[model samples]
Target chain A: MKMDVIQPFINSADAVLAQGLECSTAIGSLSMEEEAYRRKGVAAMVWLTGDIEGRIIIDLDPETAVRVASKMAGAELPESDSLVRETACELANQIIGNAITALNDQGFHFRVHPPVMHMSEEGIKSSEDTEALVMCFETPIGSVFMNIALRYNRKRHADAASAGH
Target chain B: MEQFAPVKRSKDGQPVRYLIVDDSVFARKNLARMVESFGGHLAGEAGDGLTAITEYDRTHPDIVLMDITMPQMEGIEAAERIVQSHPDARIVMVSSVGYQENIVAALQRGARHFVQKPVKPEVLYEVIKYVLGDDGAVATAAGAGV
Candidate 1:
C-alpha cells in the first residue's frame, strides 16, 4: 500500500528554514548528493515512537557545524567551541522539535529521545549484525546524513499519552 | 506535539514505507511536527529498535529515521535487525554519533542515510524524498488517529 508522508517533513523543513533560524540562508539543492557523505563528518540523532519508531541523523562537517553554531548562537562569527556547541545544541533542539510536530500531524505522535553529538569516528554499535539506511543530503556547509534501522520486536505505543508524541 | 491518525494508501509497486524514528522526547516532538506537515499521516512509530520492530510489523515501514544511541534498543542494533529481517528496509541513521567512522559503520549495517543533530528540515526532507522515491504527502493530517 502507498502512503502520504512527504508533506510533514517538507512543511517542517520549510518552517524551520524560514522561521526557526535567526538568519536563514540558502542551502541550495544537494548539487552532488551522489557524494553526500564520501568523507566523515558530524551527525546528530533522535528516536521516534508511536505508530513508527527509528532514528534521525543530521550529519555535517566541522566547518559547516561551526558556521551553523555561529548563527545559532546569534554570533556574527565564531571563536569559541562552547559557543558553537551551545548554538548547535539549540539549533538541533528546534529543528528536531519542528520535525516531531510535522510527524505528529500525520497521525503518528512521538516524543523525542534527546539530542546527542558525535564526531562520526566513534563506532555506532547495533542490536544485531546487519545493514541500515543512510539518507544523505548536501548542505552549503558540507553534507547532512539521516540514517535509519529496522524496527525490533516489542510492544506498541506503550507510552502514548505522557509524552504527547 | 498533537496526536493524529496515520494515513494509509496503496503503493503503486511500492515495497517499503520509511519511518522517522528517534528516542529524544524533544526530538520526537519536532519530528512529528515535520511529519504532520508532510501529509497529515505516518506509517508507525517506536521509541527503541525493540518496539520499532513491532510497529514495523504492523506498518512495514520501508525507511527509518534511526538514532545511534538510546535506552533498551540502540539505533545500530535496530538497524541491523530491521535490515536483517527485511533486506529492502531502508534505515537512515539519524544521530550525531561521530563524523566519518559512524557513517561507514551505519553503511555497513545497512543504513542508507547518516545525518547529525540539530537537524535541518530541508536536508531531512531531501533524504526522505530521495529514498522514498518522491511518493506520498501528509497534510495537516487532521483528526486524531493515534
Candidate 2:
C-alpha cells in the first residue's frame, strides 16, 4: 500500500490511542505481511467499500484488551467481561472511522462498515493488490496492532479517468 | 470523570434529557457517562438508527446524541426523519468520522452540531451548552444538582 493510504491509519491510531489512553504513544513496529493474518487476541475487523476496498483489523492481547477497556471505562474490569471485547471493537471502529474520514477529505469516498469481532484464528491472506501493512502502536496500556489491507478500486479509477477525458 | 456545573432546562430547571444512539454498547456507555457528568439525564438509548427513531418518539428527549455510521439505518437519515416530525429537535451527530462532507451533510439534514469520536468530555459539554442555547442554563455551583 502506498504511504498516502497507510499514513492516515498511522496518524489516526497514534492520535486516537494517545488521546483515549491519556498518554503518549510510539510506533513500536511496522512491517508488511503477505501471509494470512493470525489474531493475537481480541480482534475487531472493519471493512471499507467504494473508492477503496478491503478490511482493517485491530488486535490486542487479552490482558491489554482488559487494561485498555478498564482505562477507557475509568474502572477495573475483569478479563471475562464482555465490555472488554466491546471496547476492542469500538477502538477499531474509531480508528478506522477517523482514518476513513481523512481519506474521504482527500477525495476518496467510502462506506465504512460497522466493526465485528474477528472470531477466526486466521484471516484471509493478503493479495498482491492489497498487501497488508501491520503497525504496532506502543502505549502505556499496551501494544495495539493495526492490520491494514486496502487498495484503490481500479475500475472506479479508470471510470473517473475516462470520464475526465 | 470531571464534573461540570449541571445544565438544566431553563423552563423547568430539570436535567436535560438525552437520547444516546450508537451501535457499540461501549460507545453508548462512554457517552452516557460523559452526559451524566454534564448533569444530563439518559432518557433513552438505541443501537441503530431505526431504533433511534422509535426511541425518539417514545422518549421525546430534550437532545439526541446520534452516531453517524450504524447498521439498519445511518444517523444522518435518522436525524432527518426525527427533525421532520419534531422541527425543534436537537440532534447532535457524534461519530468517529468528522470529515467536512459528513459534518456538512449532517448539519444540512438537521443535526444541531457534530462531535468526533474518542470524545473529550469538556468539548462535548461545551457543545451541549452551545446546542441548547437559551433553552439550557448552567446552574450555579451551589445549585448544581448533579
Candidate 3:
C-alpha cells in the first residue's frame, strides 16, 4: 500500500487514542514483517473489500484494553468484561473508519466489514506474498500494535472506481 | 435526586433527553458520557438499529445518536423507520464511517446531522446543540475537545 493509504491509519490511531483516553502516543519504528507476528492479549480484525482486499489487525494487552475501555466509557471496566472486548473492536473500527475516509477523499472506494475479536495467544499468521507493515505504539495506559496488509488491484478495480466519475 | 424522565430538560431550559444506538458498547457509553457532561440526560440506549426503533418509541427522547453500521439493521434504515412514523424525530448519526455516500444516505433516510468517530467531546456537544436548535452557552461549554 502507498503512504497515502497507510498514513491515514497512523493518524487515525493517534487521533482516536488521544480523544478516547486523552493519552499521548509514541509510535515506534515501522518495519515490514515477512511473517505475521505472534498475537498479544486482545486483537481486532477488520476486512477491506471492493477496491482493496486484505485485513487490518489491532493488538493490545488485556490490561491496556481494560484501561482504554474504562477511559472510553468514563468508568472502570473489569478485566474479563465483554465491554472491554467491544471497546477493542470499536477502537479498530475507528481506526479503519478514519483510514477509509481519507482513502475515499483521495479517490479510492472501499468498504469495511464489522470488526471481529480474537483473544487467542498464538498470535496472527501471515501468508507468503502478503507483506504487512507492523507498527507498535506506546501509550500512557499501555502499548498498542497494528498490522495492515492490503493489496489494491490498481488496474482492474481502481480504474473501474475512478471511471464511474 | 429527580429520576431522569423521557425528554428530560436541563436547568437552562434545553431538552437534554437522548437515546444512543450503536452496536459497540464503547461507543454508546462514550456518547452517553458526552451527553451527560453537557447537562443532558440519558433517556435510554440500544445496541443495534432494530432495538433503536423500539427504544425510540419507548423513550421518546428529544435526540437520538445513531451509528451507521450495526447488526440486525443499519442506522439509515432505522432512522427512516423512525422518521416515517415520527416526522419530527431528531436523529444524529455518530458513526466511524465518514464516507460521503453513507452521509448522504443517512441524511436522505432522515438523519438530521452526522458526526464521525472517535467523536471529540466538543464536536459532539456542538452538533447535539445545533441539531436540537439550542445554540446557547452549552455549545461553548467545552473548548477542550476537538
Candidate 4:
C-alpha cells in the first residue's frame, strides 16, 4: 500500500508560502498533482538518503524560478541570469528540511546528505527501475515539478524525527 | 465579512488553516491559489507586520509565514509582536540565506520554523504540520475532522 507520503510535502510547501515567509506570501505561486513532469528553464535538485533513498528535483522556468531564487539569494535576478539553478537547489534544501519534520511527526525518520541543487531539462539520471514521485507547481514563466525518488533496498526507519520528547 | 471556505484534513485528522503574509502581491496570489492542496484554509491574509498583528489577533492562525524583510513593519518585527501577545504563536520565518541578518533577526524574534524562497507547497505544508500539531482542523469543519 502506498503511504500518503506526498501529503506532507504538499502541506510543507503551502506552509512555506503561507506562514514561513511573510505574514503572507512574499512572491510566487504553486499547484499540485501526481506524475513525472517537466517545465522549461531551470530546476532545483536536492538529494535524499537514509530511510528513504531518492532525490527530489524541483524544476522551474527561468523567469519565475529566478524570482524565487533571487529572494533566497537576497538580490534581484538580472534578466537571463545564471543563478536560477543555484537558487533552485537551495529551495529544494529548505523544502526537504520542512517536509522531513512533517513526516517525522508520523513516525518516520531519514538522514539527508548535503544537497547539490542545479538545473537540467533532463536532470541527473536515475536508475530506470527507481520509484519516483513527481509534483508540479505552476508559476508565471511556466510550471515546475518537485520529484521525490526512493529505492526499496534502503532500511526504512520509523523513529521519532526530531526532539519532540 | 467574507466567509472562509471549508478545508480538508489528513487521515490523521489534521486541519490545515494557513495565514499567508508577504509584501509582494505576486507571492500572496500564488500562495492563495493552491493552499487547498495541502488541506489548508486561508485563515486570513496580511501584507505587513501591522496587518499581520491585526490578523493574528483576529484569526489566531495556526501558522504565520512572514518574510524576513519587507516594506513597512518587516517580518521580524511582526514575529516579535505576535509572540509577545500570543506566546504560542506559530511563526515560521522565511528568507534566503543571502540575508543572514534578516534570518537571525527573525529567529531572535521567536519564529518556530524556517523556509526558503520558491515556496513549494509540500515543503510549507510539512513544516506547518510539524509545528502546529495534528490539531489543525478548520473551525468551520469541526464535525467533519478525523
Candidate 5:
C-alpha cells in the first residue's frame, strides 16, 4: 500500500487514542506480513470503496478490548459484556472516520462502511498475494494492532491522482 | 474560570426530557451523563433507529440525540419519519461519520442540528440548548471546557 493510504490510518489511530481516550500512544515496531490474519479476541473491519477498494482490520485481545472499553465508558466492564464488543467496534469506527476525513482532504474520495465486529472463531484470511502492513501501538490501556491490506493493485493510478489533479 | 451552573430547572420549572438513540452503550451512557450534568432527564434510550421511532412515540421527549449509523434504520430515516408524524420533533444527529453528504442529508431530513461524535460536553450542551431554544445556555462551546 502507498504511504498516503497507510499513514492516515496510523495518524488517525494516534489522534483518536489521545483525544478520545485521553491516553498518549507510542508506535511500536512495524512489519510487513503476507499471510492470513487470524482474528484474535475481537476484530473490527471497515470496508473501503471508491478510490480505495480494500478493508482496514483492527484487532485486539480481550484484555485490551476490556481496558479500552472501560476507559471509554468511564466504568469497568467484563470482557463477556456486549458493550465491550461494541466499544471495540466504535473505536475502530472513530479512527477510520478521522482517517477518511484526512484522505478526503487530500482529494481522495473514499466511502467507508460502518465498522463491523467479528468474534467468530474463524479469522479473516487475506488473499495469498496481498501484502499487509501491520502497525502496532502501545497505549495506556493495551496494544492496538492495525492491518492495512489492499486487494487492488492501483498504485500507479493512486500516484497520478495524488499529483494534484 | 467559567463554571457551569447546574441546570436548576427550566423557566417553567419542568425538566428537559431527552431521548438518546445509539447502538453503543458507551455512547448512550456517556450522553446520558452529560444530560444529567446539564440538569436534563433521560426520558428513554434506544439502541437502533427503529426503536428510536417507537420510543419517540412512547417517550415524547423534548429532544432526541440520534446516532446516524444503526442496524435497522439509519438516523436520517428515523428523523424523517418522526418529523413526518410530528413536525415539531427536535432531533439532533450525533455521529462519528462527519462526512458532508451524511451531514447535509440529516439536516435536510429535519434534524435541528448536527454534532460529531467523540462529543465534548460543552458542544453537546450548547447544541441541546440551541435546539431547545434556550438562548440562556446558547453560548459558544469553545473555551467553555476550561
Candidate 6:
C-alpha cells in the first residue's frame, strides 16, 4: 500500500490512542505480513468500500482490553464484561473513522462500516495486491495493534482519469 | 468529567433535553456522561438513524447529537428528514468522520453543527451553548438563572 494511504491510519491511531488514554503513545513496531492474521486477544474489525477498499482490525490483549475499557468507563470492569468487547469495537470505529476523514480530504471517497468483533482465531490471508500492514502502538496502559489491508480501486481511478480526458 | 454551568431552556429554565444517536453503546455512554456534565438531560437514545427519527418524535428533545455512519440509515439523511418535518429542529452531527465534504453535506442538509469524535467535553459544551443561542441560558453557580 502507498504511504499516503497508510499514513492516515498511523496518525489517527496515535492521536486517538493518546487522547483516549489521556497519555502519550509511541509506535512500538511496524511490519508487513503476507500470512493470515492471528488474533492476539480482543479484536474489532471495520471494513471500507469505495475509492479505497479493504478492512482494518484493532486488536488488544485480554488484560489490556479490560484495563482500557475500565479506564474509559471510569470504573473497574471485569474481563468477562461485554463492555470490554464494546470498547475494542468503539476504538476501531473511532480510529478508522478518523483515518478515513483525513483520506477523504485528500480526495478519496469511501464508506466506513460499523465495527464487528473479530471472534475467529484466524483471519483472511493477505494477497499480493493487498498485503496487510501491522502496527503496534505502545501506550501507558498497554499495547494496541492495528492491521490494515487496503488497495486502491483501480477501476474507479481509471474511470476518473478517462473522464477527465 | 468536568462540570459546567447548567444550560437550561430560556423560556422555562428547565434542563435542556437531548437525543443522542450512535451505534456504539460505549460512545453513547461517553456522550451521555458529557451531556450530564453540562447539566443536560438525556431525553432519549437511539442506536441507528431510523430509531433516531422515532426517538425524536417520542422525546421531542431540544437538541439531537447524531452519528454519521450507522446500520440502517446515515446521520445526514436522518437530519434532513427530521428537519423536513420540524423546521426548528437543532441537529448536531457528531462523528469520527469529520471530513470537509461530510461536514458540508450535513450542514446543507440541516445539521446545525458538526463535532468530531473522541469528543472533548469542553468543545461539546461550547457547541451546545452556541447552537442553542438565544433559546438557552446558563445557570449561575448560585442557582440563579442567566
TM-score for chain B considered on its own, for each of the candidates = 0.75, 0.97, 0.83, 0.77, 0.86, 0.98
- Candidate 1, residues B1-146, lDDT tens digits: the string is 22322332225422234465665544554565655543334577776778877777778765678776666887788888888888978777777433455568788988887766555656666676566553532223463221
Please identify model 6 stretches exceeding 4 Å from their true place: A75-80
Q: What are the per-residue Cα lDDT tens digits for candidate 4 across A126-162?
A: 5654645655554433455666665543334323324
Model 4 residue A58 distance off true place after TM-score fit, in angstroms: 0.7
RMSD of each: 18.6, 1.5, 5.1, 14.5, 5.0, 1.4
Q: Which ten residues in a row have the lowest lDDT in candidate 1 chain A?
A: A30-39
TM-score of chain A for candidate 1? Answer: 0.60
Docking class of 1: incorrect
Model 3's DockQ score: 0.47
DockQ of each: 0.03, 0.81, 0.47, 0.02, 0.36, 0.76
The digit string of per-residue lDDT tens for model 1 on A1-165 reads: 012333344334444545534433443342212222232465555565546555545655557666655443333554455443433444455555555555555555454665666544644543442223444344444444444433421455455545574
Supply every candidate's count of residue pairs whose N, Cα or C atoms clash at under 3 angstroms.
Answer: 149, 0, 2, 38, 0, 0
Model 1 chain B worst lDDT window (10 residues): B1-10
List lDDT for all candidates, in order: 0.54, 0.91, 0.80, 0.60, 0.78, 0.91
TM-score of chain A for candidate 3? 0.87
Worst 10 residues of 3 chain A by lDDT: A121-130
Q: With candidate 2 superimposed using the best TM-score fit, by how many Å does residue B93's alpha carbon deviate from the native?
A: 0.3
The sequence of per-residue lDDT tens digits that candidate 6 reaches over residues A33-82 is: 99999999888999999999999999998789878877776667677647
The stretch of ten residues in a row with the least summed lDDT in candidate 2 chain A is A75-84
iRMS per model, in Å, is: 11.5, 0.9, 3.1, 11.5, 3.3, 1.2
DockQ, ranked from best to worst = 2, 6, 3, 5, 1, 4
The predicted structure with the larger DockQ, 2 or 4, is 2
Worst 10 residues of 4 chain A by lDDT: A19-28
